[model samples]
Target: MSSKAYRVALSASGAALGAIAAYWALLAARQGHILFDTRKLPVVALSGDFSTYSHTVPGGMVRGYVYHPHGEAALQDLFVYFAGRGEDVRATAKALHWLPEGFGFAAVNYRGMADSEGHPSEIASVADAVQLANHLRKAFPHARLHVVGRSLGSGVAIQLVAQQKFSSLQLITPYDSMLEVAKKRFPLVPLSLLLRHQFNSLAHCIGVAAKTQVLLAERDDVVLPERSAKLIAAWPTPVSVRTIAGSDHHSIIGFEETWLLLVDFALTAVLAMPEAV
Candidate 1:
């Protein structure tokens, strides 16, 4: 009825709208897909003898698919992979041809992903990846275990490496930390502090004593390509790296040649397998 009353009503509406915006932002961060723009490859038909194994994690049963061809002695080195957020590990495993119709490769689901249980925290995924890798290593005692993490998953691998030494480390288009990355993307607001998932890959990567390798893409859209290069430069030891010629962040992993380069790195630089076997 009065001009003062009308002003008050407008103020209340603005406050409500701002609250809605804040809530949506919080939901986005919790989803943990800040840079996860790609779809995981389809599940490939297993061309090997290994079977899928499921184990009880704290929250729920986490399943891992093992692909090892029959009678092929497990190479001292095994590749353990952590797929990016919203992506499944099965396809990435098959896409890399890690199973190769004869060798063993293990792909794990961190909590909150398919078949895995519980909410995903940045540290929890890192811990989960390590736990699953160890389980696979013990199951196949002959194999040497290594880790590969892609994008956000790279942070997971880095954390695991900080606690335990892998045969080698491989990171694909990883960020320095989830907090820093969010800050950069949402400079207008304080997203980093609001973000609950703080995967600090840069800090953890430094602690790894194992031979480390990084894959960078020239056109990475998710993470700055320069940052990836910087990470390599910052490593105390000489971390081997290869940049995909024309690939971007999401497409790099699925490329045919990318797999070739990865296989080469894992087998030669990291694994040190004797060619005779």
Candidate 2:
């Protein structure tokens, strides 16, 4: 080959390689922003029956809220919540009245989100969930524990349920895997290779015995209907799937029907279990 022709070809190849490297590096460096979107959130004031709870995690302290309907000693059914991306979980305090009189609720900010400290990642989030579950189990030994996860939280919920048995699980607008979602958006980029916190909820569905309920939004463009359907298909046991009409990813969880379904599902799961001696 001619020297000039070879030099031009080499330059073209070098440019392509440089562009690809920059793309990979950009994604790698900005992963925390893309995944967690950690930011300073408003401080949630403790009031009524709500109280602040803190736990020592890997990097730092994780703070959250706990609602004791009948005080700590009289805890009934406990609903542990994992919130969607950038969702202020303190908002859960407002929905306490929707639950039964005896029900309790608890939610923690993901590491680096809201009041929580430390960096947020899939591994750290799941580890924090395990710690939270153990703490709650010891605190409310008699209360049947149920889980509610929305959007990104669904991945955490699925992984938690797989490791530690929960009475029931309610997943709102969940996706099978974050990796899959990324692939759809960036078909050319090798997300599987670049991504670190790929929350693969579908893979963890094996052996999960929890009674599951999935709420889907009819017009969900974020997680998309197909991704949710894939997760539903992979569930070990039969899943109760409900698609709310005239709703998108964020709004579906706000619907009155959605709350009713969550409450009813929690109650039904507990009722289905044989009486605890």
Candidate 3:
């Protein structure tokens, strides 16, 4: 081909690459919104006595709910829960019924969700977790604390565990990283380069020392079965893996068996620490 023709071809290829790069950048900028669904939902009455708590963070305040066992006056054991994206934690007040008596239950609403203020981002959420954990630790010095996270919250939980020690750690339908999930969904995009909020749970798991349990949905399609498998394989600490039968991504939490397994794991140390698979 002539030199002029070759130059023209090269110019066209460069223009195409620039366009793709711009598109990826736009996607990256909107990642936070895509990752966090903060829509407010109808509030449901809690089963037992509970109190609302709030903590100030950069930009705004983070709100959450705490439930106490029927007869308990002191914090015997604490359970800190992190719900999935798009979940209105106020609706999760019903979960208090499933928790073993004597355990204090707490769940946080991400920024801009429900009564919480400010915008939500990966960094801000993790920072808020740390702040909340520290506050709870000081408030109940003698209580044994356990952390439970579902879906997107799993990433936040892992990061918290890496920085703080807990009695136990529970993850439900977690992913290795948001970047990995994005890559799977948008294979042609350069997510690794453009992703701004990369919640790399696999990296965060390396330093977690707490006894861990991973609950996987048998038919998970949102996070993918392989993604959860990858995190389980990469976990440095001993972790017990259990699958909820006949459950998918959205329906897994609705099963009675799911709550039974979680409550049992949280309340007892009978779960043998199997070697990481």
Candidate 4:
């Protein structure tokens, strides 16, 4: 081939590679935006009084509310809660009524959500959870620590349980990983290569030693039932699975049976390890 012909061929190849690179970059950005919807949801008014809780992370502060049982119960057990992606956790204070007596609740608002600061990413959110869990451990040295995570927060809880010792871990409508969910939603996108926030809870479950309980929605539209089943099967530790009949993703938490299962599991776990409390 002539030199001019060779140069033209090289230029064509460069252009093709450039187009592929640009497409990958765009896909990554789009996936990140959709995965981490940081826009704050409207806070609902909470019915009960709650104490302010804050933890300083690398970039900013993670703040939320702490709820105690009505009377002097000595706060024997503590539940560190991570709410769903769209959840306005300030309202979680009102849900403290569902918890058994002698249990304290700490609901953490993810960074960039509500009054919390910094951008929301899977790494940052998990780091914030670690900081908050560490703080709670020190604050309630005598209390047995338990974790409850719903939806996106379940990913965070899985990571936390892998790192810290929790009396019990409860996951509500969780997925195997954000990447798997993204792949299901946007099949055309190369999620394995372009996805940034792959919150792989299934991988994290391998190291979790807590008494794990998973609550599944019968008709979960957000996290498909198969993904939850995969996570359950992949768990190395024994996990209790409970499906709420006729409940969807958002409405399952509203069911009284949901809270009853959580309360019973936590109580049973705490009671089993009475020395921890």
Candidate 5:
């Protein structure tokens, strides 16, 4: 080949490689932003008595609320929630009123989300969960603790359940891992190389001992149904699975059946627990 032609080809190849490298870097950097919703959620006027709670993490505070049913002197159980990305946990805490008397609900904003400080990542969020769980356990040592997680938060919940002891766990529209979910959406993006937050619930499933229930949205396009199945398949114990008809990823929680299912499963878990010595 002529020297001039060879030089031109070499320069073009270098440019192409550089562009690809830049593209990969951009994807890697965006993984954090994509996995976490750090924006402020719309303020909804909450009803009932909700106590504000906060936990000090490495960088900043994790702010949240705990709501107990009115007229209830003794709490029977507590529901600790890990909300989906961008979900307003205040609204979720309000909905806890659906639980019968003696039931309490608690939830915290992930770091870098809402009023919570620091950045959101798999490791940091999981660590925050551990702190929150310890706090909740210490505060209400007598009450049975149950966990509820939605979408992105499901990963955090799964990891927490793996390390902590919970009476029950409910996961709504969860995935095996963020890496798998991203690959399903962007098949050509090379998420294995570019994605930073791999919330690999499947890997943690072996450690979970809680009575688990998994709810799936029939039309969930965001978290492909198969991804959830992979986590369910990995569970050390049997997991009860249900599909809410006529719902997608975001809409599944809106159904009355969903809440009923969650509450029923929680109660069932409590009933099945051996009486405390």
Candidate 6:
């Protein structure tokens, strides 16, 4: 209870606050580089069902590409995909060969990734993805839109769903909150306070109008199976969860077990269809 000690502690706290404010100011001035790493990834536009282009899209232009079968049913809604951290559209396209033939897919480089412009190296760029999805839905009024996200992408997708009403939502290896993920990444940081971007999906899960498909990579090292299970616990039943058996985080894309589960989930989980009149 020494008055001298209390004064020193108070002074130190003020200095800490000043330093944090300065660091955050530097981050704020740097616009879209939130997620863009500037490392170019291979973009393969398929002859029939897939095409790649760097377009200026809603919420700032981004580098993105689309994929579909040569004769895919145009009636089917589009799949707007979000990829994992330190990853881009190339991973999904390459994994396409592993997937069944049906549906269309678009994987975008969020603002600041690869050839994408703007300033981003964090999940704040997810706001841009949400805007892009809304624009896509409005642009293709006829095509019912669906959004799918993987790994770190699940956080981006959750934000989009919270903001936009989509046909369906697919989340793979999703964490409960960005705070949970930040804590996993940085045990030293006081995750509750230090984390600025909390894409708290659980808080908004009830607002999701879209029927969801939860895909958990079995034995996943990157994102534990428990995380997906936890999210599904409160979600609607008939709310399906598919386990990519014998698959891990990095290998899920290529594993036969993973693709089989996805094929069933993708083909079966159509968003909006009329029931009995």
- Residue by residue across 22-125, what tens digits does model 2's lDDT show? 98899888886668778787776667788777888767899888898578877777889999988778865665676667778888999889888888899988
Give TM per candidate.
0.82, 0.89, 0.85, 0.86, 0.89, 0.73
> What is the per-residue lDDT of model 4 for residues 1-277, given as tens digits with 9 covering 90 to 100?
9999999999999999899788878777765345656676776666454677787766688787767656324777778888887677876555567777777888778777777876678888888888888777777777788899999989999998999888999999999998887777777657787787899988888988889899999898789988899999999978899999989998887788888888889989987776673
Clashing pairs in 1: 76-144, 78-144
RMSD of each: 3.9, 2.7, 4.6, 4.3, 2.6, 5.4
Clashing pairs in 5: none
Give, for candidate 5, the lowest lDDT window spanning 10 residues: 68-77
Task: Compose the digit string of candidate 6's lDDT tens values, residues 1-277.
Answer: 5999999999999999988777666544432243223566665444555555555644466767666664434535567888776576755576666544445677777666655665554454566676566656555556556778887777788777767766678887887776665556556545575455566777767667667788777787556656666778866435777777777776666666655665555555552343210
Ranking by lDDT: 2, 5, 3, 4, 1, 6
Give the per-residue lDDT digits (tens) of candidate 3, residues 152-245.
8999999999998787899999999988987877899877777878899988899898888999999987999889999999999778999999
Tens-place lDDT digits, model 1, residues 16-87: 989978876775655453344333344455555557877676768777777665553744556778787677
Q: Give each model's whole-structure lDDT.
A: 0.70, 0.85, 0.82, 0.81, 0.83, 0.64
The C-alpha stretches of model 6 lying farther than 4 A from their native spots are 1-49, 52-60, 71-75, 98-102, 121-124, 236-238, 256-260, 275-277
Candidate 4 versus the native: TM-score? 0.86
TM-score of 1: 0.82
Which should have the higher lDDT, number 2 or number 4? Answer: 2
Q: Candidate 5: lDDT over CA atoms? A: 0.83
- Model 5 / residue 243 / CA error / Å: 1.2
Question: Residues 1-277, candidate 5, lDDT per residue (tens digit)?
Answer: 8999999999999999999889778777766656786777777676667777897776878888877756334777778889898877886664565677777888888887877887788888888888888887877777788999999999999999988888999999999888888887678677776777888888887898999999999898899878888888888998999999988998887788888898899988978985420
RMSD of 3: 4.6
Off by over 4 Å in 2: 1-20
List the lowest-lDDT window of 10 residues for candidate 6.
268-277
At residue 13, what lDDT does model 1 achieve? 96
Candidate 3 wrongly placed segments (more than 4 Å): 1-25, 43-48, 71-74, 270-277
Off-target runs (Cα >4 Å) in candidate 1 are: 1-13, 20-25, 28-48, 71-75, 98-102, 270-277
